[model samples]
Target: MWANLALSPLHVAAGTSVGNGALLGLTRLVSLKLAELRITDGDCAGIAALTRLTELDLRNSRVGDAGVQGLSRLTSLQCLDLTWTQASSPPALSSLTKLNMDNCKVGGEVALRVLRSTRFPKLHAVHMSMVQVDETGRELLNAICSDSASTLDSFMLPSASISTVRFIGRAVALRSLDLTGVKITDSSWGTLAMLVSLQELELRGTNASNEVIKSLQDLVQLQRLSLRQTRINDGALPLLQSLQGGLTSLDLSDNDIQGEPALQQAWGNLQLLESLQLLKTKVTDAGAHSLKQLGASLRELHIGSTDLSNACFLRACEKLQILHLDGCRKLTAPVFQSGVRHLQELQALTVSDCPFISKAAVLEVQKDLPLRYMSCDDEVLFSAKKTEPIWKSGAALTDRLQELAPYDERCRYSTDELLSARYSEFVPQLESSGPLAAVLRELELVSTQ
Candidate 1:
């Protein structure tokens, strides 16, 4: 029920109790969200009074067709989200610029009827994820695409078929396209590659082939492309090499591109890549070395659940800001000594599941070079949980160690003097022992002093 006297975004979710009087009073409200609530058709009636409302989100609400009818009076509304809600039948919303009706109970026919009736000259974005569509729904979608293809900038649909995808291609003005759950194969790639204006394209879980994917090299304007969980391989990557200079973000995570040869080929290019994700992929130390080429341009990098060892971190990626080495089992103390210590620009580092790294070592490194966020496997300073009986007893052992007595007066001498004195004291005692033993004992004595 909180809002300023002027226009602002108001979000109220999780079935929070909001009275009608408070909702009706926000006449100047620009955006109002009432998601996951008990709001019904009657509650929506109060919203009709907010004539200036430009954005409304009623996702996961109990609103039905009647509630949608009540919102028809909101002439100034531009963006409306009815995701995971019972509301299906929408009124003619000519002013809407963005509409999201994902996972709604309504059939595509009713939704399309509303869409077909509405004139969205300025509408640019629409997301209908997980919504079932019939043949009639497909026709309506085609008709809607035909109507708004010139103006639409973004469109995301989960169950797009090849025909529906080709129809969507008519949206020449589109800059972003997300077809995550679509069944489009190599046949549809030709139609998709025609979207030369696309800046961001996501084909996650698609059946796109390497040859079909490389055809998108014509999209020189493309910046962010995600082929995660696709059929693309190493050979197909070189086709995408045309985009190496302009592409800023690439997500090839969760693919079958195994070994260093394939990974090396992928990383050999892309000098301007700012973010890269290679989680759950098989890559060895040799492949990890390929990342050194990116160096300063690489800002955010994730290499989780890989076969990379400490040698992977030897690369001088000095400008790296965020690094994720989660589930890299071979990584150990050398990660801190040889790799992390040198990355001066690192802000956040995640080393979870790296069993060889200890919490104490991480704390010491952080003390030397402070970081904004640091994550490890366990809550304690050590990677593994403490199993010692004393630790289980939960005594004030750590506090006692912090309050231990100072060094002896004789130990106040310089480190070099202490080492020289300790060598003199322990050298004769270990003279009969091997030279290695004598040297070890002398070093231990110096350390104790």
Candidate 2:
């Protein structure tokens, strides 16, 4: 019987090869990911036998034309990534849906073969960047652009030209766009305004200006927006507010988002927001206070490198599960003691580069450790080291409880928290003893009832 298997996101070493005999039992593979490495011709020929392959990623590798040519027989292949490879000729694949050949040597001849609408009608997304194409290639590129604009729902190309954007700007069906890597200095930045159907947009580290920001206000369907490392300023508040009702997550990190007015102006109305990132901004105490309006809707916050005071945690909404306080110079241990206690839902916390917070200080504040993961004082920490050993076997835990002359309040509190969180509360199959274990059994029975 053939097993359902998929080996993915695999980084191969240089000169990685596998003979057909070596893969004796693996008559076929579900997927082969040989990205950023060199595979021999023998390996390429051997890989051609994998007719069952559905996904293949060959990004940034030394895969030659012969290696990619062998994949033509893989009729079931759905997604193919040939980014930054030397493969020039890609055979017409009938089942391929997505093709990423960014920074490849595909010229006019290859474009005519792959981009032609007559051959691979199933192709939906065509991602290409920095491809040197001849005059014939340019003509075929226009045809592909026209075809992709009318039918394709997703088109992503960081190296896409201005003309390509103009063509796809008419794509009313496009939903997800990752043009963050595109450096648009002209009206091309404004072209995104036409994509009203877009549900996700990432413009991180791009040259988009205030005018370009205004252009995106019409994208009401957007649920996720990333404007990190951009020239975001107070002028974009109205635009943000326009999308506030629909946005669930937004990243405004690494920008010149100074003062509280910028946040207060637009963020107070974003009650539906579940996650927000403002790392490396100059947000003040009042700016953070605006987040309190979100209440329980806010779940994750990244407020690193801000000038906020100790009250930052108190104002960051109490229901946060993930919090990052790295590079927070103004905050001290008292913030954790006072504000973090209210954050019972917090599972992950990072306080790296904090001048005052030490590992010892965090441990001293803890009675029953609740954090599943924590990073502080340049050391990585996990809750398993402190609590998981006890949870491994409930019988052993019952023995430890019996030895106790008096039950420590901390022990009781932490155990209750673990039970409530349901991460490590019981081992039902294993038998437990002792009076404490009996009490736990009764508690579990009652809780279940």
Candidate 3:
């Protein structure tokens, strides 16, 4: 039965008896992925016989304590993904090379014990999000990294309340590190700069300032760096410019970086830069032109929420592939006709919220370019055809009731009359405004309803 087993989603749900019948006829089963199944303690008996299984993914399944106990028998298992399951005491996963338990109920001593006890000789990547990994946990992880040598490469511990900075100097072999939503002091940044082998680093939602940017200059091997929602400003640009020769992708999105001088000084040296995102930044047409200077190697560019005209985007039309100009209400048709027509590789173009762009301009671009995807008014618009309906007929009545729920005191009419009203006080205003304006109108109407 084991030799004839064909792993599928249907086979796992039919019960372990059916799986055991299939496993009995199999000789070599390398991978077994039971993702999003309702497997219970009884199903563990079927997995115990899969000694030759190398990869196993039991993510989003009801694998309780008994199910984990059964997993201990499979000594040949290399990769295990038990993400989002309810198991406080995880079974010893010594043979696993990659383990993922992100957003699980496991916490405190039990979480640290799993990391401490698991003797994974080949373990490289570990994803343990929403776990309580404090100072002592960092110490244990440091020991693991020091012992693993070159094997440990990727570590994602986002939402793991890591207040102290203890494991920075120890994890030298780490290539990709995601420290999003972690609380780290200035000293932590200095310690992290010492890890010379780091390639990809994400400090999104962290309190890292411009001072830490100088320390990051030492990480010459870093290729992709995301500083979204950080306190970095113009002062940090020079330090980033130092890594121009090696760095390829840079994200400064959601930062309060004002003016064009910092961008010009930093990006001027980045001859190999391909992807750059300035989403929600205060960059204007001047800043957009400064970025266009790096057009030789630039492929993907996002300058969302800025007051940029289509002319600013036309500057780098040749190499641009994915361009997001969302929330740029000032963009006109002339910017597209003159510049965007040259971009042969342009696949995805977003022109959301720019009411100035006439329907004729959109049709012209669609006719001239090879754009596979385009979005306007949150609806797909391409090839001079509108495929889907934007709003349902009875949606207006339902929306009016929801809007009036918060401020029923202000309305003189009854709930039944408001629901049945052909022309409610909110309906006319919602129809006139755009999507974002409509949402704001509803909030205002609720207060007066």
Candidate 4:
């Protein structure tokens, strides 16, 4: 363990044998991630010794008030993530440059005061979801913004009753701001537009409308914008197009965007756009045809739950690499045979719940093309011949056996099938593992499978 201590972001979650105390001895560690270990006061003492740590993520841990007290000693820590930790803090994170205390129990005025008094000279990003910030707290934030020595880049203060827009306008260097579930009106959009350096803005679940869109037209460096569940509609399209060739990713999912003409007129103008997600929209093939105009630059496209057919997708397959047609029931076999064959660079394809796609077509495509990744529901069918099945039963298991069963009649298996019989399997051994463990396992399985 000491030999490999140079690896930053060392995650010792549920399954691994490494304890919290052993992890603490790696004083050279810059990033320590021990999430969902059911860590308590005793476990946090180990973390307190990691004085040189910059990023400490204890998310979903059972750490409580005692654990919070232990974290106060980590003065060198810059980024502290306590999301879903269920910890009632005495505000131990004063020197942190980035702090995420989302869904925690640090919402009172005392908590705010403790956070405000902290000497975060380089604090840049903060996430305080479900915290109760009143007028005074906003004024405190305003004071923090006025500090010329500090550089706050991103802030998420959902449920904070920040009424006035003037306070935020003062944050000249802010790049990303999320005020979801706040009472800020459309008029505040003008004030927020003054933030010249703002790049990614998320106003999801907000009351802001087309006015916000119009206000953001002047932000040239803006790359990613998410206005999910907002009142903004097709009227916002023109404002979005104003960004034109600059914006790379746009997510207007879960809105009332209807018909292809609106999307066509909107997206056809984003020439530099690479990723576009229009999930649960009223877009049809006509709208998809309009999207095809962007085929030259678009790399990742998601049209889930939309009224689209294979023909629409085929029209734009020339440059698509990551295609997600999940829940697009109308997709047919000819679509894969014709449309997918043209996508020479296609690396990952997902057609989950699309009853129209047959197993035979999937195998034929794997045999004919050089796809590196394919996922259908719980199973991930792949083309690698040396990999073994990751799971043997349940919906999580791939039906690859059934697909290969017919060819193998009493050792009559096809030579190619026999060579490719092994399927990579992923099964978690630890019950207390965090989401990251699952992700790592999946990634390892993907590389082998």
lDDT by residue (tens digit), candidate 1, 58-123: 876788877886788999999887876776644577787887766654445556667556655666
Q: What digit string (tens of lDDT, one per residue) describes model 2 on residues 1-449?
A: 43334444233443676455644345457766665556544566666677777877776667767677676877888888787678764556767777777666665565565655334445567666555445555554445545456455666554434333555565556787766456664566667778888887767667666677677776778777788778877566666776533778787888877546645464544577887777788877766776776766888777765477665535457787767676677777877567776777776666666687778666653454467666665455444332322244443343233222122222343343434532223321111212244445544432221
When 3 and 4 are scored with lDDT, the better candidate is 3
TM-score of each: 0.71, 0.69, 0.74, 0.68
Model 3: lDDT of residue 293: 62
In the range 11-77, model 4's lDDT, one tens digit per residue, is: 6645554456576558788887765566666777777887888887776677776677677788888
- TM-score winner, 1 or 2: 1
Which 10 successive residues of model 2 have the least lDDT summed?
A: 426-435
The 0-to-1 C-alpha lDDT of every candidate, in the order given, reads 0.64, 0.61, 0.63, 0.62
Cα lDDT tens digits, model 3, 284-324, are: 77767666667788777766655667465455647877666
Candidate 2 residue-wise lDDT at 120: 49
Query: In model 4, which runs have C-alpha deviations exceeding 4 angstroms?
Result: 1-77, 85-94, 115-119, 130-150, 156-167, 177-186, 204-208, 262-269, 310-313, 335-337, 361-368, 377-379, 383-446
Best by TM-score: 3
Runs in model 3 deviating more than 4 A are 1-28, 88-90, 106-118, 134-140, 263-268, 342-345, 383-449
Residue 2, model 1: Cα distance from true site in angstroms: 17
Q: Which 10 residues in a row give candidate 4 its minimum summed lDDT?
A: 425-434
* Candidate 2: residue 66 Cα off by (Å): 6.5
Scored by lDDT, the top model is: 1
Q: Candidate 1, clashing residue pairs?
A: 359-381
Clashing pairs in 4: 387-422, 388-422, 388-423, 388-424, 389-423, 389-424, 389-425, 390-424, 390-425
